[model samples]
Target chain A: MTESPRVVGRRTDVSGPGLAGAVTDLVADCAPEMDDVLVVPDCHYAFHPSTGMVTNPDVVEALVEALASTTDVTLALPDSQWVEDAPSMLGYDALADRTGVETLALGEADTVERTVRIDDERHTVTVPKPLDEQAVVAVPTLRADPDLAAAMVTVAEAATGSRERSDVVAASAVVDPEFVLLDGTYTFTGAPHKGRFLVAGTDAPAVDRAVAPVAGLKPKAVDYLRPFGVGREAIEGLHAEDLAAELPHEQTDPNGGEQPAVMGAGYRLYAKMTGDLVPPQFSGGSDD
Target chain B: MSDLRVGLLGAGNIGTVHLQSTRGIDGASVVAAADVVPDNRARAEKQGVPRTYEDYTDLLAEEDLDAAIVALPPFLHAEATVAAAEAGCHVFVEKPFARTVEEGQRMLDAAEANDVSLGVDHTIRYQPEVQTLKEQYDAGRIGHVPLASIARINNGPFAAPPARQPVSGWMLDPDATGGGALMDLGVHLFDVLEHFFGELTVEYAHVDASMDLPYEDSALVVVSTEAGTQATVSAGFFQWETPPEITGYFRLEGVADTLRSEDHLPKQFMAHAAKSALENVSKRARGQEPAYFKPTYYYQAHYRALKDFLDAVAAGEEPPVNGAAGLRMVEHVQTAYEMAEGTRAAANAGANVEVTDD
Candidate 1:
């Protein structure tokens, strides 16, 4: 017998009290039985939240406090490609102190392999052993990673030490997170702008699909998410407001189209006037 | 005179800077380059280096170089410098000289044994503002300077905005880099301090790491020179909002007046550059050779230091900032670390225990 798919829980507030209350409400509604929960936020690097590159730490703190009610929460992040210094570099150390949430470098953690299906093919996926077996929550920012969007599914895949797009897709299924806390406190398309809202759901695929509109994308267009059996329906949410109305949904020119060209030219002229080396954009690549 | 042919070792961030600085010099040419990373080697090639190698040893062996810039990581500085000295080439090494004072001594020994000139890129002293400050202090512009303080802090060797790429892990590793902000930045301050004052004795130190990263990301060093001048040196890795957003100040408090390096800075960097270009053009038109200096004064320190080393190599003279000076900086850093370690140990020993003179 198949269990009924869980509904989504959302809250829209900019204040600290509002965010913490919203996250607590969402966690309580989605998975009340959660114990020993692992929070995987989009902490790719130590970029400021204004970049829309990483999840705001405020969102992570709210989730930690929310999870602390029924479970022990640990903030887990995958190691960076260059080195294992992502924790301090990303400013998670400060968050840990403020929230009292223990931090884990998932890359340094041991892995365990599990079988999962991807596009009708069974693949062996290795995930951090401690995290794989525990209840996980992915708190991702509202940002379009060029064509693909970074949300729960991407955050789940990042908990493992995999780089392949297909592997990330497969790993997302293996972790099988209990909830996705979509931190739309700020959203990134071409640039970051405050899109204050949060989307929470247990169904990773469904949550990703439902939030796709917030970034002005059809769920069907996200390539890695295509193979999953997720649907585009907001079954249930704490905040019954229309999220699409609140979303700016201004899509970026993925090619870096005209804006970069204009900026590059301006900088070149500035360099010439100053007798400075015609900055790299005008000089072109060293190879060129 | 023939050009001073040079080989570049390690085409990473600072290595790339050295490659650019070496290129800007009139009688210096980078003939060969080496780096473990393929991308770095490719970048070096693009910077007009004709030949590239995956290993620095290969570059040193194959290239008939008059001198080599040891721009590899702090860990490799000793091995690479020794190899260059053994190859009958002068060596200009990037700082913190070495991971330890002992390692720095070994590199110095190698240079002396081979009779090759050794120069450390202690570029802080070469900065125009720093030089101006020093000139003013020496000329009694700030009469009988009694107190001085130097601080250089930035969110570097790691930070966003300015960083086009991710920083390598080795920079954060205590074993690889010796120490964090203290070793990375303290040595530069020490060089500049010693340049203004005579010899310095490390009085006390305190180091703090924001996380459990094996080493301190921030440091505070109290030092005094033999000439009765006391100074405080503060350095950190987590101090700025962007690249080159450094909080560096060298202030001399004298009986007669107060002098600051910030006061001597070019009012507007671009305007100064434009004025310098115009002056150079005017001089060239009058059949006078234009004044020669680094293209960008911001990085002119690195260029000047390297150019001085090449000049010394060409003249068969000693480098102004020789191996001994590099070793002195390392020794100062070593003393500071030892003092910090002693403080930590004392604190730990005092924990959970009470002492009373009964």
Candidate 2:
């Protein structure tokens, strides 16, 4: 029988407990059959000034150190944001300099020019898109601008020569005041796509079940992930039956916590204004 | 006094509630109950009903009754009520009267032909709070009523323990319940609205019904009367942990008095401007008291309706809450349901269906 795939997670929140560490412990306790490990920083940290993307320099150093000691390990990052600032080139240069590990850039011919300003050395390198055969380009948070969303529909229609609007998936951002940056939304119309994590196999129910708690979100908050070909119905179909016996009992509290009073008040106004018998926002979907 | 025997058609929840209500109402006795379910017969026995029959005709034929309470499901209401009317019995039926306007008309026809007193249990109309509103409006205290709103948010009937039966259960089934909250609760609100203002013409309405359920669990209906009075009724069963509460408030154009009910018991009418208006009216009419005053007792309005119906039955005169009033309520509910169902279908079809907007 084929073994379960090794999954990696990144802790997005800064103040809370590290999500990666939590995931590792939970996986060890609940899903022992799957082999997983958390990678930590070793020496040199990586930072992207433009997008505010930060990676532990020591973690990259440890990964390069591991390449010398281990041969069969596959290097993986959390998402597309990690690779925004010449990540492959920087990683390759670091590894080659430290441990003579041959760096091969494999992919189609699309040039990405970057100027690296190091101590007394300036170098420009043109790299191609990472190939599916050699290394996969994973984009965990691929948020779409509203303009891009409309453009995607136009492009999809042009490619397929069909006027069907249902054939396109749209992505958007749902920016709340508190968590403005990380809030993203996606929608898929016709079929699922690749280049993103497939939480589970063909079973939409299983995929949905594996997402929450693993992703640290309620099922309703995950609707934005639908447009990324994540199988929304599968996620929606997930019930308590699909979960493992050891999963913590869901909270029974009515209000959940001291959520923003405006959320509740706004929802009430929306209900009255729309004459909606039940407020759609409060129905556990994206109120945005 | 001779035994005032009665037969009951329908052993459903409402039927059982009626049975309990009937026990308290003097001079009425439920002799036999008939229902399609054998379990319903057991229910009757459990409720201390003397005799039970599977067929309503059997109960009508066997029981020497003064009246029959037709509490069957809505679809079966017209047939059972018409049968009771033909059998020469005063009929007390549940709200919406029948499933369709046509069916309601037929029941009315039967009652008219037999010359039997037909009273509808538009229970909300009989609600003391609603009665207070009606009394004030009729007394011209709340001068020409311009806009009224009736809002009822209850745990859908099926949310209750007794109602939480299988999917095929009577209340859950559309054919049995007739049309969800709009029919069940909306009927009552419509009756109250029509009672306050004369017959209404539904200018526009927007209804958003349930998707997963076979019937609508919620409805939002807006209607206007022929006399230019507008009203909105929002009914639903999504409330989680609250006992049902119905709030009816209307705005009068010229009247400055504010009518408020505390704990739905004592109704208070207060107004600084209307005090002079009231005093002038009271002075003009020597013996007549100022109509805009506080209610003396609790639920006096329902008691009045009950007394009126009983008085009409005793005098062989037409009952106050008649078939036509019930029919008008049913028609409004039907229109709302149709609007909701149509909107939902269009939404599913991916068509831009614009709901009625304010």
**Model 2: how far residue B127 lies from native, Å:** 1.5
Model 1 docking category: incorrect
Error of 1 at A222 (Å): 13
| Cα lDDT, model 2, residue B105 | 88
Model 2 spans with C-alpha error above 4 angstroms: A1-288, B1-3, B37-43, B46-48, B160-168, B244-254, B260-311, B337-358
Candidate 1 residue lDDT tens string, A30-144: 7647778888887665555656657787788877877786678888877755345665655678889988888887887888888877767888877788767888888887776
Clashes of each: 0, 12
How high is the TM-score of chain A in each model?
0.79, 0.27
TM-score of model 2 (CA atoms): 0.49
Cα displacement (angstroms), candidate 2, residue B165, comes to 4.2
What is candidate 1's lDDT per residue for B123-163, written digit by digit as tens? 88988889988888889886887788998877655553312
Best-performing candidate as measured by lDDT: 1
Span of 10 residues, lowest total lDDT, candidate 1 chain B: B156-165
Task: Point out the worst 10-residue segment of candidate 2 chain B by lDDT.
Answer: B290-299
Question: Cα-based RMSD of the predictions, in order?
Answer: 7.2, 22.1
